[model samples]
Target: MEALLILGGAVVFLCAWVWLAVTSRRLPVGLFVVALALPMLTLLLRRKGYSRPARLLLLTGILISAAGVALLYREQPEQFDQLISGSWVTQPSDSALSGTLMQQPFVPNDVRWQGKHLIFAEKAGERIRRSLVVKFDRAEALLQGTAIDLLPGDTGPWPELVLQWYTGALEQPGLRRLDGGYSMSLALAAQGPGQTEMVVHLHLPSEFGTRLTGVVVIDGQPQWLGKSAAVPEPRPAPEPAPAPEPSRTWQEVSILALLDEPQMYVGQAVRLTTTSGKEFAGTLTAVTDDKRVVLALPQGANQVDFQFHPVDIQRLQARPRQ
Candidate 1:
């Protein structure tokens, strides 16, 4: 989104520059674009010169030009934070939602332009260790209601029921996950915890399968949701690192911003990457006058080596935690 904004600004600046070159000396670049594009567009006016329709169209363009500039300089207000947190998920004696989304009243699966990450409600405690998807915003949400987690098994002897959940049937409230347990074709269950449920059909890797059954909560509202997932056991706590003293700490910038810098001094180390496929750690090795960057191999780096790419790369992040 920011990239698009920068690009649009550059295009406008370019038109202003070109207009300044061709127009009369008295007008500023801004005024030139506002005025020049007008006469240039006169050819589009089919009516004869000084005609009523021609004057109306020209006046209309001037009005639109003023409106456009007003919009360009306008600072829009911050967005409403629709992100849900806390008991919205876990405490549901009055409700069972522990995560976002379900914590809020279901308002018809709405339009969310900013977006979310992780099926928080479904994932609960799962960690996305070393992932390849790049997303700067780690906003999470959960689709809670009911779901069926399916697991695989062999032949009639075949597999884990946890690998299977009947959700296709819940989509329209008429679909089903067949109980006979073997057909590729699914069947609907006359059963449900509500008039509608958010069904998740888990297709496990072809090899491993585990035990499956109704996901029952020991404490909170014992929701008889379709399926359950094995909450991943938390890892043993690692030794904590010393927090940086404020005096020694440095401000951080996004990799995108670092790329916009006209130059990088030697030994200028910066952090990049985020939960998304962004670069979390890297050093700026070189920079060009055009505001493009060259990232160096990271300190003690043992993974993929940095390579040359002619196009502008947006992967390296330099955002520092405050």
Candidate 2:
């Protein structure tokens, strides 16, 4: 059916081009034929009488191609429809399937099965509820045929993967928890008879963050587990500072008066070093003007994002400058 559509459109375009070329130069409208010959197939028009064979042929070609385009459109309406994909799981496919799955209480954080949406935190899980729609742009639409509607379901358990290959970016696997300012990445997904497995990854970018990878399975009718989304790239692990050896067993020092200025001022030139002795060059912001020194880490310095003032200056000095 799709092939026919393309064939019909090609035929129509070819016919129009033939008719226009034959009538070229004789009629003013045949000038349109000249433009049509462009590699881009543009259909610019110039006023021309229909007297010339080329003009008439071009007109005939235009009509034929238009009709062909319509014919092609008629053959693939399903590709343009709202509901292109669907799935249903009457029973859980977890290896640990237990009747307790059916007995799980309807708690907000708990996943509840209701033959429709899997209600998690009172929100619909695409796998357990109505299908989600994803609409791509023109180029993507051409490749995948309009918008696609797909269902999200349990493809496997945690440490396992919950795969969703359907319609919307929002419905994509790693986005559900993004609402809570969290993100995830998927590693793998597969299914088995009476069993399914999925592997997921999660990363928290905030302070004291962690990266976790694990698999999960659902073998019962109703299973509710706090499933983390897959992390795209484990936030590059914060580089571990060199471990302190026994010889380096030293107490920390203070920086009471290391700068000429009493307190860090906005736009004040500053040179500083961390307790770990990392050097930094930056300007002070409006904040931390009192005792706190808000040092802007260099552009690409993330893990070394902030700097604070040391209460005492006994140890942080420049080692008494030669």
Candidate 3:
């Protein structure tokens, strides 16, 4: 019985897609219905005792259907807007106050356009206050948001300007605040004097519903934008600084040199090997001007001090830091 339901749901989903492709008139509506239904179908299939091959086929179908819907929305956003509201027809408006700032489903409640500046505002809720602004001068492009500011020196071409802005923004402190806990991207669609076209892409969390939202702006005016694409993955954080190089104090030196510069080895761990094959490890205590030395060695319970002539020290080694 469960297998039958699983098979039935898959058939219905495919039939819906076929109906959409064949008619081409109600594509968005059919795609939306299928997108919503495909998951439920997959869920039912998983609960059933279906064979592995059968379950895999159903899951693959869900992924393909979802990808197709995403592609359609990306390539033909205007058409997708038709299904947003029965009364809300998709149309372009010159004034930001009246026309839709973005496509349906993501239509901002408020949009303000001033000379060289554009502001977008969404309906305020209890937890989130969403807004964005873009300003441009002949010498610089400024993007100020709720949490971060992208200040890039005037570089010709919008793409390069955006790229530069992105690079600099990463270095700015408190980037997570600007992102509002979501992934975002800025792209240059076109550019001109007194007018610049761009897109603000947002990949919100799954709880926010749509993962991608593209806001298209032209000449400081929003043309059309919507939440429709996958958010660009964030780059990895930088690697940590390499550890400091170890100190090199094991170099060979003459016993007379040690006597002359005993201050250099004071308080340092030193190992002295004599010509007779005896080794002594201790802290250098003192060196007399007459070429005499004092070594404090650690015995079982107490430290033993030894006095020796500089010539008795055949080899000296200084231990590095722990």
lDDT of 3 at 92: 31
lDDT, candidate 1, 1-322, per-residue tens: 3234444544554454344335434555554354455544433444323234433444454455545444433321111011122423443242222211212221111111112211212221231111111111321111122321111221132221211111221232111222223211111232344222222122222232311111122222213323334444433323225456653343554455444542543245544332212233345566655443455543343432232222223234232333
lDDT of 2 at 107: 17
Over the stretch 1-322, how does candidate 2's per-residue lDDT look in tens digits? 5445445555655765665555454645535454455512333333443224444454555565566445434543322231223212222332221111112221122232233232222112323221111112211211121111111121222121121222332343322221112223322223444433433233333431323233454333322222333424323223325345643322222344434453433444445543222344454553344454555544454423343434211133111111
Question: Model-by-model lDDT, in order?
Answer: 0.30, 0.33, 0.43
Runs of candidate 3 exceeding 4 Å displacement: 1-245, 320-322
**Residue ranges of candidate 2 with Cα displaced over 4 Å:** 1-6, 26-75, 80-223, 226-322
Clashing pairs in 3: 102-225, 212-227, 212-228, 213-227
Per-residue lDDT value at 116 in model 2: 21
lDDT of 2 at 243: 42
**Candidate 3 per-residue lDDT over residues 241-317, each given as its tens digit:** 53455563454556766777888777777777643234666777888665556778776688866655443456877
RMSD of each: 21.4, 20.8, 25.8
